[model samples]
Target: MAQLIRTPKQLGVVIRNAHARSGLTQQALADLVGTGQKTVSRIENGHDGTRMDTLFAIIAALDMDLQLGPRSKGGKDISEIF
Candidate 1:
């Protein structure tokens, strides 16, 4: 099955969970990325309009990879094969 990201909020939830699983607090992540705790909180709460640099920093801090590709037509998507 394909995992679909419906909204920025949903993405935020995933980021938050991943961060927790990696044993890093929001403040610690913010410090690592040279951002403030409030910014991290906003991101965690699904606030869209975050800067690309901020997003990249968050992804790096979480030790996660960001992938972009076309959506699936019906059931399985080409992205799943990769």
Candidate 2:
């Protein structure tokens, strides 16, 4: 399933849930990403701003892909330009 993440908090929640589903602890994910556990914790909590490189690393490590698309309209994908 694809989720449109419009906020950092949403991204945080997705990553946290994904980590759990993958059976990885904060420390384990940190080790995989070559970062600190505290950093992962902060990111999961959405309290600490994360670097783009780090965010991409985390996403990749979790076997997730990030996509960019045109803005949605009223809770639906914009399929018509007119």
Worst 10 residues of 2 by lDDT: 73-82
| lDDT (C-alpha, whole model) for all candidates | 0.82, 0.86
Q: What are the models' TM-scores? A: 0.80, 0.85
Model 2: per-residue lDDT, tens digit, 55-74?
A: 99999999999999986566
lDDT at 41, model 1 = 88
Candidate 2: where is the Cα deviation over 4 Å?
Answer: 75-82
Taking every candidate in turn, the Cα RMSD to the unseen true structure, in Å, is 5.2, 4.7
- RMSD (CA, Å), candidate 2 to true, equals 4.7
